[model samples]
Target: MTDLDAALSDINASAEEDVYVPFEAPEQSELDQKINQYFEGVVVRKDLVKAVRGNAVVPGYVLEYLLGQYAASDDEATIQEGIDTVRSILAEHYVHRNMHMAVKSLIREKGRFRVIDRVTVSLNEKDDVYEASFENLQITKVVIDPDTVKANEKLLVGGVWCICDIEYVHNDSPGSVPWQLGSLKAIQIAGVDFDSYYQGRRSFSTDEWIDLLVQSIGLNPEQFTSRGKLIALTRLVPFVERNYNLVELGPKGTGKSHTFSEFSPNGALISGGEVTVAKLFVNNASGKIGLVGYWDCVAFDEFAANRKTDQNLVNIMKNYMANKVFNRGNIQLGAEASMAFIGNTSHTVPHMLKNSDLFDELPDSYRDSAWLDRIHHYIPGWEVSPIRSEMFSDGYGFVVDYLAEVLRSKRSEDFSDKYKAYFTLDSTVSTRDQDGIRKTFSGLMKLIHPNGEATEDEVRDLLEYSIEGRKRVKDQILRIDATMRDSPVRFRYSDQAGTWHEVTTVEERQYPQLYPRSWNAEAADASGSDLETYAPPIVNPDAASSRSVRSVAPPLPIVPQGGGAAVIPDDDEPLFEGIRDFKAGQKGVSYENLLLPYLVGATKIQIIDPYVRAWHQGRNLGDLIGLLALAKDPADEIEVTLVTGETDKPHQKHDQLLMLKSLKDAADAVGVVLRISLDNAKHDRSIATDQGWRILLGKGLDIWEKPSNPIADARQEFRQIKSDTTFTYARIPVS
Candidate 1:
């Protein structure tokens, strides 16, 4: 029997002996319980990997594969026993590079031993035989048969982590190899039943499934917003979506390469310069296939500006990424490998948007419009949080190997047209743009609604998100190539109700001044259509001008009104009085930006928020007071009154008062008079200024989540908005 067959048989034998019973945790979350109930044997506690992976440099799939075997149960005794077993196995059999001599000595003494090491095989032309090399053992020329190599072809490319059985034999004859490969099984899920996976998905709501999937990928779902969760999942699209080209550029340490490098065995992540046409597509001299033929996804890391790139490789890649085919000599070959490029951006999004296009950081050769257009989606990696200690999940999640297998099996299914039932893309969208949208929509549906069960709103959300991603790519392309401006692409969609929603990237809304004015003019000319727009008031970057005008668009919920230039108002004029919406996960928002412009002339301001009882709430109140101090003339003292709810507990109220007293002292130091009142009867939150404008706050001053690091959040824009908020301005009589 084959090694893989033997491994599957062993697993099946174990399954027969101990049929899986749904694990019941004593105090589990609803999502965790659902994950365990639907996929008991395939789920493992994510924290356990760190506990057992003391100094090991192995990927998560390798460690989780072992953990899933022994630690899948929720019972403490079983989990403990499993952890012990896994620890013992790794301690004894797992090969460490520094201790290879000891393992070799053990194998020689015992005549045969099993070791967990990465094994790579290559054809030795002179010997006319297939030879295997052990990664950690520092050994080569071990003979492996053709049948074994055929069964596991991945051993030829980047190598596969495996449980290997090796034997040492004394050799007296010349040219006789002493090392023997008895058996080898690649560390991966042997099989996945798609039917069971689909049925299991049916048991989960979309939100629950998204959380479960995020947890499986080793992230804390609670730390991410719904939009953030979708962006994170987009990284996995290349794995499940065939020939999908995705690029993510942002600051480092955002886990951009984590999914490709560690989440799945079916993916290969190499440095940008390490790739070549021969290594990626085909070797003309040897007639050997390359990485694309073996892996489902080929990802390039550190794919930023100023890297040396070969023109031939770029030309070949352009064709392969566009058509999924490349010419090797006289033969045309096709590969299903998706392409992912992840790099760090040297500048912030606004800087890039202002100085050059978003693709400005790419190497000169790759920044070509033809090459950039093939990208299916462009992820705004800046929106993703940097990896923090608390971001890693400790709860139960699918064993990554099982999840990988599920993603791989789904490539054959198509949900590309699912969005068409509810919405239609704008005619201005090109065929290529439509293709990118459909593929992204298909991949997201396969992930969130694999059973093809979704409400119209859910489908619309996915469709719009897909359009925004592709639109981000197109919008940047227009900036990079002036020639493309002749045929402008408008990213909009129409629902069955005949209402059009214009989709804009969150960054676009946040920095309207940085966006290209030419495209905004074209969009304005087309504004005759029924559209819903959520355009934030444009702020002039010139600090000398305190007056800014809001972009006028037809008011709607989801669709964007066409863009227009901001009409700069006089410095003495009041700021535009309108409602401004901020989405959750949006950054660059502060009390100074949201309200200070309107509070310019007010000497007295009354803030009414009933929920300011917590420590963070008090901090928010202090921040607003500081903004008020900035708004008032230095010669004039401003009076700020805060009306907030008080806790019933005596100790809590005492602590709150102490915090408020400290804030008052700080306010007094800045020439601001602070008055505090306990008001449990107030239900609404607003800021009333003596300057004739009343600003209604949907979420009050507590708009941001508690920052991971308060000092950093203040110095840098690291905190994301926790709640979707709106600031509605009403003209009240001057107090």
Candidate 2:
């Protein structure tokens, strides 16, 4: 048998006998193996268990007790047996929808059996009187006297988990009856110590831990796509970072809410439009604590597009995000709980960038500069496509509960300095900008390159991407309000002798067809181009003094081309000659189809997209790399470099270098190279022949769909390959 088959067979054999012997088995006992097998690879159904067990909202152990039943073994018979046992336990002991009836039945049938329930109780120890309140069964204000019970004697009250008090009644009867009693153990259930659990499981590597989690959830890790793996990894970030505020705004049906609602005990999901200041922080009247106080991470589901939020609350949230301190009745308190906000966007990326920005649709309160500035990162929700059923994995992973705790313990460390040695940010950046950029940089750095050993280019790329992400937020604000000044966080050079340049956004450099102002209007207009005239309006300095009516220029006419821009069809296309020969000049297949299949395994790909040195091309290069990553295998190694002209900013080169470094590191983890080469050549777009076997043409690295409102679907149906675009492929003969 093959090595993989042998391994699988051994694993199956061990599992058949109710034992699991990992390749690197520790000194674990048979029971440990059984417990691991039971909990590993099973996703706990939190809502179902919560619905069944009333009165007490017990922690995850209760649900784990259930998952352990359904996911005990790989064997169907063994798993069925475990499920039967679990079902019996729940049916016999757990309170149901009719909690009062269920509790009553339990008390009558079992007589004195112990039960689990949430109870709120008040104690007057000195007076020997106590009052108890139950939530699920609706029992409230039940008074009990302690004097009737023996001093310091513990009694199981009502066969339920509780702390109570009892007192003797002076009556002319055969025996003294209990007059008063109190209980305190209402919230206490059989909770596994989280710290101990995490500590015990900390020895496993991240991959191993992730595998364990996937296995515990009963999903194989190998079946998941790269993006799927990333989505899964994101779930663990909350657990890894203390107070790690994460926002994943992606397409619908990506299972964004699954981890928060069903994965672990430490997480809670608050539905959209249901969050209030009191619920998030502290309630004044009842002195009841909020979600932040109770849960390690509070995820706001469907958090986007709420227009009716309170301004005061938004302001308070800004403070909380910036300082981690929120005010409660003139008191500022700190919390280590992380926050997550998820929402869906109605518009596509290109449309959003063209007309507004990612944050444009947000409510005015949330749109405040201070509030937006405090958000550490803004995930490109549109880029994360809807999850397909096929994306789930079949490999092993850690239980969600175990993974969450690992993330929690890892938050104290920072991995930012690993990149600091090779590169540095431009000095012109502000603290707010720096904070936004650095927080994102640091968070991602912590996530992947936690040891801070990332190369110079790796650090540079991440910094640039982080800066660009934050810029996407800032740029939209500008479109919404022209009064907002441009941010000074330019990606410039730190060295005395600058060798590189910067590109702030994709619109600034490439897609001159979209940005008329940046386009060379003379050249474009001379080609019988339908390009609109984009002359800057001359402002009359004295108009304000006399209130004179200024003459307005007539609207520029749009001359539409017959079939878009003219293209000179090549008779001798040497670039694609090699590809045509390999495919035997297949008539029906386009260049994209011919070349894309071979490009899938490439380790590094280079694209040369240059504009004015520091303004646009850098971003174009970065975006190209991102696209290549989408097409390539997640584990395949690759790198991309952009060769462009020098820019005017003294620090632009440094910023570009740093950006490249960050990208390199991110790519390295996922198997890609990110780099930049400076060249002053004016007109050239060619993919390096040495990096791989094929080259792309027609905007080389800048191919993008036309901007559309409400964003067109990303599926292959709506978008077709550019017919005029040229591509070349050549086989690099094996040495």
Question: Please, what are the lDDT tens digits per residue for candidate 2 over residues 1-735?
Answer: 112224334544543452222222124334334435544444332223323333334444445545444543444455445545555555555444466665654444544444344444445455455555554544544464454222212221212233332222335656333232333332222334544544434444555544555544434455765444544555555655556556666555556776676555566677768878887877776554566765567788888856678776777677777787877777778876777778866544433444545675676677676676666556655444344334443333343454454445557776545445655667766676666666666666655454454556667766676666565555444445545544333544352245544536544343243333213234345333322422222222222122122212121111223435423323222223332211222123322333333444445556555542442334444444544555543323455555554444655644544444444444433334444555556356656534345454434543334323332222211233333454454545434
Clash counts for the predictions, in order: 5, 88
Candidate 1 stretches with Cα past 4 Å from truth are 1-27, 517-520, 524-735
User: What would the TM-scores of all predictions be?
Assistant: 0.71, 0.52
> For candidate 2, what's the RMSD?
19.7
**Minimal lDDT window, size 10, model 2:** 549-558
Q: Report the number of the highest-TM-score candidate.
A: 1
Pairs with backbone N, CA or C atoms under 3 Å apart (clashes), candidate 1 = 501-559, 502-559, 502-560, 532-559, 533-561
User: What residue runs in model 2 are displaced by over 4 Å at the alpha carbon?
Assistant: 1-62, 65-83, 98-100, 112-228, 242-244, 444-469, 481-483, 491-735
User: How would you encode candidate 1's per-residue C-alpha lDDT over 677-719 as one tens digit per residue?
Assistant: 7667888999887766788998787888768886645731457
For model 2, what is the error of residue 675's alpha carbon versus the real structure, in angstroms, after optimal superposition? Answer: 44
Model 2 TM-score, 2 decimals:
0.52
